[model samples]
Target: MTTRGPLLAFLLSLVVGLCLTVPAGAVQPDEVLDDPALEGRARALSAGLRCLVCQNQSIDDSDAPLAKDLRVLVRERLKAGDSDEEIIDFVVSRYGEFVLLKPRLLPQTWALWFATPLVLLVALGVILFSYRRRKALAKSPKPLTANEKRRLKRLVNED
Candidate 1:
């Protein structure tokens, strides 16, 4: 039927949109803590921690087994009465700082954070320098001497 074409297109688009979105419940029911307060802390921590396998997705949004493991580890730390800072420190010690989506501001990391701005400033300087040079070069030439004018006219005739 002619009507089926638009309906099929609408259904396909709806399915595609849903597929592209991150699943809200990547953490299994088993991983949820018994205490709501601890569970909320675990969820918040999971959201900040990057999924090593997925790279871009947070552990809370990633379905990777390693992400699941990390989530469990965070909950376990919470159960043990570790402060949020201590839990993060423990993970960072084991996995290195790459596990964090946002790199810490350390002397070594200063370059990583500043590289983009430095590059942009250098590029702007180069652009401004070249623009000034071109503008400077565009100034009118000194008036040709009578002899030079004669030579130019002669050269034009030869051409």
Candidate 2:
């Protein structure tokens, strides 16, 4: 009886953990294609495309009407025998590059891609400069004033 209680608790926690860890996709049953290969391709493509209505979520993971539309469109394109690249191009042409979860590296996007690292480097340089300045100041003690030196000399004489 004692062992059963611990076992039940462990099983309950395991089930809850599994439920939390599983991905919650928004793809409906009707949205799935009969052909597993085509469906797999559609899912892969959908995962790369962003849901414009839910900016942070992929179309595959979003429940927005627009995301559903995009998923359906992707499946339709696959059924029409469009290659993955062609479908991606068609969507990109219609919606612009912002629909892509990862934007293509181009001349214009170079700055966009590098901006974070550039900012980080600049911040690191500033931090290092400040640290070095503080260290240098600490290492070299401030010179004693003339009055303080005289006081020290008189104290030594009394000693």
Candidate 3:
């Protein structure tokens, strides 16, 4: 009975953990509309936005206040008859390009977009150069003359 009690408790906890409750204030009720298509569009747009409060997570995945605010903003834009691009541009203008999960391919942002690969290539070249230099340093020159070899051996042995 004692073993069964612990097992039952563990199973109950696992079931509770698996139950995904949206939580109070995670999403505002007013943001969702009667029209399923518009709600779906709002959801899709929200998924591409980075939550400022949870920098690595999309607004759709985040439960933070800022994420909720962004979600509402998307729904509001949709309700106002804004096209997807217009809504995205509005958010980008308000929050800067950092709000976008995928940055635009404009001239201003091009260097930032390419910097990571360039830095990686530079790092790889540095590593290769160091490895070659170390290998060169390890390779010994031809053996010295008999007299020189004897002198070197004596000095090394004495040390």
Candidate 4:
């Protein structure tokens, strides 16, 4: 056999080995659904779930054990014939709204959604108030007392 034949075969084997060893995010092979449509829905739901252990990463993107469990839970919910919203609401009820990447706009979440704009308005008001006060002060002059007027006359005479 030629050296080229052996070298090509070794390179191909190495590529295939590397591909097989790399884990695809948190989804395991056994967790995937046989139905492509259901599998797609599971993936979508996983992407929306915040992994409690990982905090910032979605269950679909995190490798934490909790994230894997959440991924499996999402698949199970899908298999049970739950609609996407129902599955999401079920998870939210168990984990609180923190499990959602984008939390719903509810009374409890109003402060979170409105805090920045309210703070900005307050800051802008403070800035504008201070600026107007400084401008008014600059425009008005205080009258000097009689003693200060006499001192000014003496200084002018000396000059």
Q: Which residues of candidate 4, in runs, are more than 4 Å off?
A: 1-24, 140-159
Q: What is the TM-score of each candidate against the true structure?
A: 0.80, 0.73, 0.65, 0.69
Residue lDDT tens for model 4, 1-159: 579999999999999999877645768788889999999999889888999987887899888988888888888888899899999999999999999998899999998899999999999999999999999989858899999999999999998
Candidate 3 local lDDT, residue 20 = 47
Best by lDDT: 2
lDDT of each: 0.93, 0.95, 0.86, 0.90
- Find the 10 residues in a row with the least total lDDT in model 2: 103-112
Ranking by TM-score: 1, 2, 4, 3
Residue range 52-150, candidate 2, lDDT tens digits: 999999999999999999999999999999999999999999999999999999886888799999999999999999999998988967789999999
- The lDDT, on a scale of 0 to 1, for candidate 2 is 0.95
lDDT of 3 at 71: 93
Worst 10 residues of 4 by lDDT: 20-29
Q: Which stretches of candidate 2 lie over 4 Å from their true place?
A: 1-21, 141-159
Candidate 2 or 4, higher lDDT? Answer: 2
Instruction: Tell me the TM-score of model 1.
Output: 0.80
Lowest-scoring 10 consecutive residues by lDDT in candidate 3? 19-28
Q: Over the stretch 59-128, how does candidate 3's per-residue lDDT look in tens digits? A: 8888888898889889888989999999999999999999999889888899888999999999999999
Candidate whose TM-score is highest: 1
Clashes of 4: 0
